[model samples]
Target: MADNQFSLLSKRRFAPFFATQALGAFNDNVFRNALVILIAFGVAGLSSQQINTWSNVAAGLFILPFFLFSANAGQWAEKFEKSRSIRYIKLLEIAIMCAAAIGFYFKSLPVLVGVLFLMGTQSALFGPIKYSILPQQLKPEELVGGNGLVSGGTFLMILLGTLLGGALMAHPGLGTTWVSVAVLVIAVSGYLASRHIPLAPASNPDLKLNWNPFTETVRILGFLRGNRAVLNSVLGVSWFWFFGSMFLAQLPNYTREYLGGGAQVAPLVLALFSIGIGLGSMLCEKLSGRRVEIGLVPLGAIGLTVFGLDLYFARPEAATVTGLTAMEFLRAPGSLRIVADLLLIGLFGGFYIVPLLSLIQTRAPRDRLSRIIAANNILNAVFMVTAAVLALVLFAAGLTIPQVLLVTAILNALVATYIFSLVPEFLMRFISWLLVSALYRIRVQGTDRVPDEGPAVVVCNHVSYMDALIVMGCVKRPVRFVMYHRIFKIPVMSWIFRTARCIPIAPAKEDPELMERAFAEIEAALANGELIGLFPEGALTRDGEIAAFRSGIERIIAARPVPVVPMALRGMWESMWSRRGSGVGRMRLPRRFRARVELVADEPMSPSEVTAATLEARVRGLRGDAA
Candidate 1:
């Protein structure tokens, strides 16, 4: 499963997973898009008060389940077979589709609103299980590629769903009936596809449950509290949803006012944005070579800023009277730049988000990963709600749609600053990046041999924590670093680790529970199509030579079917903090301005025959003449 990239692409194991994901994405958007159409167009045919009230109800119903049922769903994800769980959920969609038909037939606002809530309930349930299952089905190196595909597939489905929704909603006779029928077909197809999915055993068996959202929310936070990286990654992801939700929600006004188009233009803008994200996501898998490379964070951050700012500047003075075709949109005033900005923004967004997601899955403790996801879901909900409120305030303040977007872009910079400043690992990578650029030049061989995206377990000799940071700096994707829990607690430094979503581990003797959590996190990361970086030696080299490799990494690889991409730190160990005695445990020490480093990749090794011992041996072989 590891390096059999073609095999993975060909097999039932992955195919079913892909179908299931695509179907889910398609269905959610189908229902959501229909509802949006109803509100935007169909509502005008009714009383304004009725429209406002129904819209309010619909919004509340849709969002309430995340607050109410997400905790329980997350619990279920951790306690049962993931595939079995997904199958049952797919069946639930059929019933929801039936409800959608009822709503559309009667055009009953209350019934439709109720179904939207029910749909949200379905979504809430699927959220945890969906993410928690990825690490179980794919290989480590495939996590990024898998995630890239998933993200790419999801947005594509989003586009498809919207397109279908528009087409169906347009024809009075076929609109509602066909939507229900189409939903029914998709849901049934998904269920059938899911039946073929391989079973994924739960990571935690003797786990306790708290169905209560309040108590469960507390518990979920407690799980995140133990690991700063998990907490920050959760924050980073929440922010994406927060900021992204705001951006997507305002498209109607943006298209109408800023771009000088009408309702038709709104979907086009969304299409462009979504397609951009899809394209960017695919590029991550191609760029990163299958390992979770943290460098993508900085890269993503840069793209987000560049495109967001450019989009603001790309705005035209007045709206266009005619609805332009996609190509015509390019010919409109500032339109080409706007489209480019949006697409590039989405492209970088994929790079930014997929790694952190993979990091979360790879680094969270397995036993509590569901709870962690639940916590993440809750946080995401909170941030998204805040985004709505913030948008309302901005709009109410008389800000134009584009102006609001500009403000959002400016806010993103501040948010990123806070997160990165909070977690120095991201900053540390930047520092490492600078050192490599200024002092030592890097020449990578066999870089093409690395999988561009997916969950990957990267094995390299441990010289310093800087080893992970250095690797993160060179690689093109975001990586979830598996590091000692103590190192994760270092002040300021811990923030970087947390923000970068490093998985914290405790040695078995000190805290076996934590060891379990680390494994769970790794599983979750892989499940989310992310990369997990591990130092097989487990600790920094004491005598400037690689230590005996541990079997923990092998266990992770065996659990997740991702590739084991080995790398060599040819020059880092000799430069900055390779101190014989005092350097390993020393804190707050600085090696300011006198360091040189180079990280070189070797070929990826499949987990099929590459046991921990074998992988360790390969890493040792690569360390030749380095120390």
Candidate 2:
């Protein structure tokens, strides 16, 4: 497996699909923006009212297919091979663009609008196939990185398409002609690229087709409710669209009226926002250590709110000057602050969304993943429409654009809080991630040795009080650590332990009943196919040396008869949380911050081979001299 996500871009499995999707996005925006420009500029020679009406109608036409056809689209994606379905979808795009060409050649507003609707239908069909195919093609460890690339590429293409489309339509005579040709060529190019995508077999080959959009939409939504975490993650995704659309819808007006900028400044504002998202999306793999770290979601939500609120105060009043170009706006007083706020909002938005998509992909039932994504598409459309309606209502009540943005930012905080409350795992993971990352520069190895899905026992050396947090942060999956009951009760750490579902165990001598309960719980967790993390040393090392393993691990394995994975934590003895010193002086401030640490894992041993002494040796060897 490639350690870096960008490495996937050079491989056949990902590169072709990336090209096809990026080109398709570019074409869609090129056509849409061109049509909008044509109408707004009276190239269609219509009355002002007609132009306004048609512009609104064009936006509605594009979004309508996601609402009307997403149900059937989801079923088709599941029932057919994904690569072939992509080809067919691209072929449909070619047909739509051909029609759009004719519409543009004759300057027919109605025909162009109809072609836009067909384009939406093509996109709606592609939506489910686009995401559901990732897990099929990539390894579990690569999912987050893959998603980051896709997300970043998408926004980048949208920016490029928007710019190109507007540029083509701005031409003197042959602007429409240029757009029509560009769309056709891009459509054909996307189809050709789709041909290179590796075959992805149908997820539900025998799935009964559902042609009824209304009933299937309702039925598929029920799939979401089957998993609460998955459902909320889906909601989180839709809420992002709502938040994004709200900001995007107001950006043009905000740039013009408040920032005192001309037409050029709107795209610059968009570029800053889009670039931020792209950069943030790419950073997720590194920040998350290449796991689907939903911890970043909370961090993202906080940034979105903080920067969004700051945007209003950065320039609460309208610009004192008007018609400044992009560069001029940059030099204006307080303009850089506004620009920074927008950029950071987009950056944090990237941080917020990528992991949620990865979570839905990994957690949603494989056979039904397409339908779940389709349901997500439906909800996204609804939320985007609601955002538009809400904006209008706010404007009707005479709220300025800045005030509306402030309200949206505040609403973002409330919505994020509610969602996080519903699934505290996101918040809990965030806390662990924040604390661990702040204190240590961790290097992880042999994580792939841990089974992606199964029941197993993981035994590691206990070097510090912060060991569990470090292990939890590095491991791709959730771990229920068996910790000393006293450490589990340690003030701030206690809340984290409880929230993470860590099992608190007392020594059999001190509390036999609690020890027995902990053993029983560990057994139950294993039976449910969950990973149980145990520090067989049973206590933090007082002298920075490996201690004798306890018999409790042997007892658990003898009862459960499952595989045991041996792991080690190195260079943690000198950390502030470890019991390395002779006195209470050890509790004082550390001599260093962000100390280097490593978590290493060895292959799993069968239950019969996993004695206390043997597992201890394996862990010690993995730790080596780094301790």
Candidate 3:
């Protein structure tokens, strides 16, 4: 709609927030990498074991604040205007950077460690404010793109920071001085950028700030249970973090032990992975047609598992050669497969996370969006900790790095399967999307004529058995279809139909009771302000032409009195599922793959104006000889 996701970068509303967040990420990574470098090489008078111990301690110190302060941070974000809070948070970062500068200059390990803890605290507080403000600042249609750009920029900055920090810290005397100066400058720049961010009003101004983390954590998680979809999506996102953490945490060892690479190679591999994720995230806006399509989540999960397993198998047979650098590894036989696996794994991760983040913002109650994001942060920390523990357990059990990767991949499949089973809408949407995308290239027109929210009846001229699936894929929102009972019972599609809660009707003469119940359910759904879709023609066209509109449309409107939106599907009677012959005796297989099909919606008619004949004429005019 706005050219592409990158167009958002030129706009005033999103640009400042983008720069501020990216700078924050860059500063976080630079400081962390600087600390890691100091422990590994710069710091003196410490044994290798002691260095490892301190490195682990620093990691814990950083993550611990997320566990302790996320709940309170969530409350703070909701209780205050977000831009104002972010400005103050950035100011806090400047002060922390000053402390870090002093710590770096003095080469005092204790000062640096304390400064790292404060940096982590700053991040924990900023997490909720960042996500909750997007819904307030952008339109619903812009959310996915905004999130994509944010995610891509954040990862890109992280890669840059890691590279720059490692390079700067390795220098002789100017290393510490330069690192301190860079961090301080970045911190000041971040604060300046925050100044331009527009004010996002508080989501829950009256919410009491809960000081106790333990009790507040439980209460927030409890509140999250109010929406299973939101909660499950949050879990799904956390699992990705768990999966990603395993790869990132073990990458150095993996590069050394498995690929026989040096310190430089691990960072190169990380860069490749980061680039892949950024590309995949930017592509989501295009793949999803600028909507929050949860269908992509299952697709992403499948890719995550598949690519992860391939990565395990992709490990090249340990060559007799040693000291292979990243460039040499790339030149080696079979190494490209490993690189491809990592890149695709990161790409799938982008697809998996962006929509889920958008879902969290949109599906969670507007009044408590920040708290829910906080709950997500807490759970993400928990999941990441569990992943570390799991990796350790696997290593203790005598598994190789590749074997550990294989196990995580297998576990990912099991977990994803279990999650999808619990929430079949994701799977159903994926299936419908797959079916339509595989069979035809659909062009939807007048999609905006359908209300974005609220109860409405959509009547389309049904041309094929795949009508509902096509509609489901095109419509951004989920719709409950009122379909034929026989069609609903189709072998493989039955499961999807049942999961979608499609209401199936039979002819009154054949099954009066079923017809009555179906009508009752449709009315109840309408009463609940849910979208209900039906074909007023009642059955698929037998001759690639619109059949006479049935009186059932009149009955539906008379009972529910909701707006009736007339739509028409053209170029579908020739599809595989259509009955193009004189009778069922001449049913044929799919005639074309990737055929062009169009769905056109007319302006919604008021209840009093939606006569069967009038709706039929409107649809016919919209179809306009495209049959």
Model number with the top lDDT: 2
Q: Candidate 1 residues 126-208, lDDT tens each?
A: 88877777878876667777777788789889889988887888887667788878888988898898999999898887677
Worst 10 residues of 1 by lDDT: 439-448
TM-score per prediction, in order, is 0.74, 0.95, 0.91
- Which is the winner by lDDT between candidate 1 and candidate 2? 2
* Local distance difference test scores for all models: 0.77, 0.90, 0.88
> Lowest summed-lDDT stretch of 10 residues in model 2?
583-592
In candidate 2, the residue pairs with backbone N, CA or C atoms under 3 Å apart (3 or more residues apart, or in different chains) clash, namely none
Q: Who wins the TM-score comparison?
A: 2
Residue pairs whose backbone atoms clash in candidate 3:
none
lDDT of 3 at 52: 82
Please give the TM-score that candidate 2 achieves against the real structure.
0.95
Sort by TM-score, best first: 2, 3, 1
RMSD of 1: 10.2
Residue range 48-101, candidate 3, lDDT tens digits: 899989898888899899999999999999999999999999999999999999
Residue 466, candidate 3: C-alpha displacement in angstroms: 2.2
Give the per-residue lDDT digits (tens) of candidate 2, residues 499-568: 8889999987899999999999999999998899999988888888999998999899988988888999
Q: To one decimal, what is the Cα RMSD in angstroms of model 2 from the true structure? A: 2.2
Deviating ranges (above 4 Å) for candidate 2:
1-3, 583-592
